[model samples]
Target chain A: MEILLQQIVNGLVQGSVYALVALGYTMVYGILGLINFAHGEVVMIGAMIALTVLQILLAAAFAPVLAVLFSLLAAMAVCMALGYGIERIAYRPLRNAPRLAPLITAIGVSIVLQNLAMMIWGREYHSFPLPFSSTSHQLGGAIVNDVQVAIVVIALLIMSALMWLVHRTRLGRAMRAVAENPAAAALMGVDINRVISATFMLGSALAAIAGFMVSANYGIVHYYMGFMLGLKAFTAAVLGGIGNLRGAMLGGVLLGLIESLGAGYIGDLTGGFLGSNYQDVFAFFVLIAVLILRPSGLLGEKLAERA
Target chain B: MSINKSALLVAFGIALAGCGKSETASNPASAPAGELVIKIGAAAPLTGPQAHIGKDNENGTRMAIDDANARGVTIGGKKAHFELLSEDDQTDPKTATIVAQKLVDAKVNGVIGHLNSGTTIPASAIYFKNGIPQISPSATAVRYTAQGYKTAFRVMSNDAQQGKALGEFAARVLGAKQIAVIDDRTAYGQGLADEFVKSAEANGAKIIVREYTTDKAVDFTAVLTSIKGKQPDLLFFGGMDPQGVPMIKQLRALGVKTQFMMGDGGYTPKLIELAGAAAEGAYASLPGVPLDNMPSGRDFAKRYEERFHQPIQLYAPYCYDAVNVMIAAMQKAGSAEPEKYLPEIGKTEMDGVTAKIAFDEKGDIKGGAVTVYQVGQGKWHAVQTMGGAPAAKP
Candidate 1:
């Protein structure tokens, strides 16, 4: 009972973070039809930048709330510029080449960013400084900390705001147009380049927030922190239907819940033959099952042939 | 087309010249006449999560080489100018083997590290095959020394001794009856935990549950939550501080008030800094007596801090001792060759900053000590010292 409840809470908080990162992959996939593998590095950069800024501000004895806000904005701004630069420098030049070129370039960009980060930050894990001591609140029998609650609430708000921005704004319409057909969108005076770049900036901004949430939740950040997370979030995106916004969100949360619940119950399920250390296996297993059963994902639409 | 061809030719010529320059740089002809440049290879995870400890090992080895050179060591009546060739294994076993082979191929006179037991065990085979003496400063898995590899040696206590001390302390000293154990599933962590469980159970403490996690994992919520349900009186984790810090933090966050403890892998300044408030009252066992109690330990620590501009992390003193012991063997044998000086290491008996350096038949340190430390007011304080000589004022 309480174990189940505790697992659910854990799953939800973790899932929300995955969903935020998944949106970056899904948005880029939707707009450019290219999997921006470097998106994960963008999240890492965001966290690193935010952490550095926060540390400096805190050392200067700034207010905690204001310091957090300033650091987040700084991270978002840097990530936005980075996303734009990556698309311009790496992808734009290969736009007319074979699809594989851009895909490989995305991986190259990711590697470059990772090594660059390692060189700049070194390899030690930096502890995320918390302004307030995390106090746990009990619900029934499970414990929920202030950080976890903030993560869930903030993620929900940002995700909802994203939903509104993508569906109800002029930029959203342009983005949808660009995703539908860049040639057609350009013909319709959509300015395909601007729409694409905007989509990337928007996604990167979300990635920055996701990075902050991850560091805050886990209380530690490292140069290699983004790789596994990006891989998992990408998995969540694919499980939700790679190019679908709602599918990505659903997949992220579902994957998180599945991981937490699977980890929580695996010991009992296997009769102690396996342990929670095999937690990673559950995510991939469910991915394989989902891919085999529903190729288009739970909420993904059937692929449409374009003329 | 001709311009492009000439440009290509020029670039090729420049690349060849660059290679030639490096070749000349490493050429022994550049050394002063009658001076033998003896290369000592050091391998450790110099670029990953364990980089801090790895760098500490490298720095200690470097300091030893510098000191040896300053003293103008002579081997076979030749003035020996010691040179350090450090390689980053990134804490990966595969990389460790590659680094070991690289060191052997470079014809290094001796090897100083390959820090973790997981790395050291695999790399030891490579060193053994090449007949190169390898000394580990911190690899404490009992299997490392028990492998019958004469080339392998360590300066610190093995897991068998450390685990027994930890187990006895948990049951007898702390009086924790119900205990939960978690290991990172690495050779060192798992081996230490297994030994700990054996001794703890033998001491009449009931083992409630055992769990495993990877060294790379940052979150332990699910595992801690599950363990919380068991309501164990104490949770003991056998892993490095990178994982241990988060496990303890997450354990506390889950509102579990169970006592937390870990093996030497958790006994690092980084643990206290990262774990912060969560680290309070946490117990960890570190092999060897406290630095303040060692002969010349305070002086060595002062010199190390002055040189490195940072306080000594765990195992630096041991690393310093391992290098000096290897060099001492070379001096005793009157030759720098591994085969000639290898036997001298077994016969070694010298006072090190950590302890009186000596090796048993298995190449394990003789009479190695283990000390249990508890974090209080954000600093680790030694609560109990087990085995080895009585504390001597530095």
Candidate 2:
């Protein structure tokens, strides 16, 4: 029972970051009908940029809080800029072309960003400096650390803010109109390009927070860290009903919980044939099961035409 | 316009080739009379996470070549000029095999790496088929030499020795009755863990839980928590520094308080730097004497620092020894030809920076020493040196 509680806590922390990253994929998919496959790379850029800033600040002996704050802001600002540029230069050029073109281009952009990061950061694991104490608190027999709490809380806050912006704001309405029909939205003076660009920036900013969260939570970062994470988050987005905002959150958290719980008990269930090391298999297993059983996701609304 | 750009690109490519050729041409001893240039191929992961260790090994080989040239070593009555033809295998098996073939095609007399066991095991066959000698400075998987490939050799103790020593150390010295073992499931990690478990059981320490992880994974909360429930007193991980650092951090965060131990993969300064205070009291074992404790290690470290501007990493001294041993065989056989010197290599016996360099019948370092270290005061301090003999159960 204690182990289950511990895993639940672990899953929630991991899932919140997945949900945060999934939001970027879902938002971009909803607004522009593109997967923005490079969304994961954007998250990596955010983490890497923040790490560089933090390195410099720590070297200068800046206060831990000040350094973390500045670095967080830098990561967001840089990733937002990158998102805007990526949408304009890569996705925009192929917006009216066959969807496959943009999909391939997104993949291309992801590879280019990964190699660029490798060149910039080198392909080694770097220890991420934590501004706050990593000490855990015992709560109901479960271990909870400040970093995990911060990740979960910050992710929730970002998701809430995103929910508000997407539903209650003018940009959100414009984004919704564009997602409904780009030609019609343009006729209605919705400024389709602007909405798409805004969506990318907003989504990327969320990814930036998630990037910092994951880097801080694990206390390690590397060039290729974003690839597997991005794949998982994309699966989460799809599982939540690809174009549904709330579904992405549900799917991400659900996937995390399943993975944690599954990994925790797999050895016992299998009588030691399989072990916790195969935990990653649970995420994909859930993905495949969801895709087969509920094509539109648990909360996703069925669309007559697929994006 | 396209034609002109194509022409310009061609010109640029040619100019780059010429520039490369010029540097080689500038080498003072290239094809000089009475000088037989022997190209020794070195393959390792020079570009991935393990690149630091790979480059360290390459640097060791480089130092050996420089020293050999300076000594004007002769073979078959000709002054020998050694050249290191290095390639990055990128820590991948397919790449390692390709690199091995490329080295053989380049007609290298002897080869020096393919660092990880996953890579080295596959690449060893390529060297064997071509009758070229290859020595691994860091690959410690027992299966590496067990393949019966005469071309395969290593300068350090294999995982069996290291793992048994670790298990015995934990059981006898630390007196831990309950132990939990976690491996990354790679050939090196799993093989090491299996051996550790065997010896631990033999030493009367029962392994309570055996978990597994992957090389690239950083999250261990689930696995660690599962192990925590078992309440094991000692937690051992069989993985490299990258995963070990974070695992240790997570373990401490969970407040398990289990004594942490790892194999040679976690035995690096980088691990200490990454794990921070969490690494305090953590134990790690290396397959050879600590670099500082080696006979000529101090001088080699000073020279390596002067040359590379970085302290010697884990495998540099072993690599230096491997290279010198290869050259020694060449000198003994009176030729730098692989087939001629290969037999002499098997009979190698000389003082090396890492040990008294010699190989058992299986081509593993004979009676290779294993040194167990514990992180104390922010540094890995050698606690005990277990000689080549396997630890006896007490």
Candidate 3:
């Protein structure tokens, strides 16, 4: 029972980050009808930027909390600008071309960003210097650290804010309008490009937070860290119903739980034939099962003709 | 549509032409007139997680070549201009094989690396088939030399030796009755863990649980949580510092206070730097004595740091020894060609910075040493040295 609780806590912490990154994918997919594959790189860039800022501040003997706050804001601001720039430069040129062009360009942008990060940060894994030490709390035979708790709380708050923005605001209504039909939204006096760009910036800000949470929790960051994370978050978005905001959140948490529990108990479940190393396999297997059983995902609506 | 098709064809044609030009450019003619250019190929993971150690190995090899050139050695009555051709194998077995073939195609007189056992084992075959001698500075898997490949040699001790030392230390010195073992499933990690388990069991320490992960994986919570339930006395990991640092950190975070121990892969300054306080009291074993204790180690490390602007991570000294040993074999045989110096390597009896270098029949270093270390005060302090020849009089 204690092991189960521990795995659940682990899963939740990991899943929260996934959900945060998945929001970026789902939001862009919802508004622009294009999967921003490079969103993961944006997250990596955020962590790298924040790390640099934190290093400088801490070296200058700045207070830990204040340094963290400054770094977080810098990361979010840069990522917002980056999100706006990516849409403007890469997607805008291919907006009128074939759908495949933009999709391929998203992947191209992801690769370009990864190489650029490599050149900037080098390939060595930088140990994230934590300003504050992680203090553990005991909870019914399971242990939870301060950083884990912070990650969960911050992710929830960000996610809740995103939910409120997309549903309860004028910009949210405009975003929904753009998602419904670009031509119709334009006729309705919705600036399609601006709404789309806002969606990306909003999602990217969430990505920056996710990146910070990941580096803080894992205590390590590298240029290639974003690739696997991006892939997993994409899987989460698809599992939750790609364009559905709530579905992305649900999928991310579920995927995280499945991976953690599978990794924890796979040895016994298979009578020791398989080990916890098959943890990644459990995630992809769940994805395949979901795709086969429910093509539209658990909460996804039926396919609608876009053209 | 027709215009797009033509444009694509033209682009494809240009790409093919570009490839052809680069291929020819890479195949430079050997022996540029008078000076005999002795090309030595060095392979390591130059751009990935292990790149730090790989770069160290490359730098060590480059330093040896530069030193040899400055001294201007004569090989077979020709003034040899030593050239170092370094390639990034990216720590992948497939990439290592491709790199091996590329080096062989370039007709390198000798080769010095492929840092990981997973890579060295596969690439060794290519070097053997091409009649090129190869020396690995860090690969410790017993399977490497056990393949009976005359072309394969290593400066460091094999896993069998290091594991024995680690197992004995864990069982006898640490007095851990129950142990849990984990490996990254790489050739080096798995082999080292297997050897440790065997030796530990023989020493009466029961291995309660065995878990495996990949080199690329960062999360080990599930593995740690599972191990936590068992509550072993000590947890031994066999993997590089990249995975090792994170694993130990996560283990500590989960409140699993089992004593942590790892092999040479975890014996680096980066491990301490990355793991922070979590690394305190953690144990690691490395082949050969501590760098400060080796003959001429202090001088070599000082020169290396002066040149590279960084402290030696791990294996740089071994790499330095391997290159010098290979060059010494060439100098002894009076020829840079592999066919001439290949036999001389087996008969080597030179004193390297790391050890009194000599290879047994199997190309394993004669009496190779292994030193166990524990991190305290944010640095590794050597606790004991096992096997190998006794420390020579300074």
DockQ of each: 0.68, 0.58, 0.69
Off by over 4 Å in 2: B1-35, B389-394
Candidate 2 C-alpha lDDT tens digits along B31-84: 577679898888888765677678788889888988898888988898889888
Computed on C-alpha atoms, the DockQ of candidate 3 is 0.69
What are the per-residue Cα lDDT tens digits for candidate 1 across B153-172?
A: 99999999999999999999
Indicate the worst ten consecutive residues by lDDT in candidate 1 chain B.
Answer: B20-29
DockQ of 2: 0.58
Candidate 1 at residue B132, lDDT?
96
**Candidate that would win on lDDT:** 3
Best by TM-score: 1
Where model 1 places Cα greater than 4 Å from the true spot, the runs are A304-307, B1-31, B389-394
Tens-digit lDDT track for model 3 on B331-390? 899998899999999999988888778999999999878889999999999898877787
Q: What local lDDT does model 1 show for residue B313? A: 77
Q: A124 in model 1: Cα distance from truth in Å?
A: 1.7
Count of clashing pairs, candidate 2: 0
Docking class of 1: medium
Clashing pairs in 3: none
TM-score of each: 0.94, 0.93, 0.94
Q: Tell me the TM-score of candidate 2's A chain.
A: 0.97
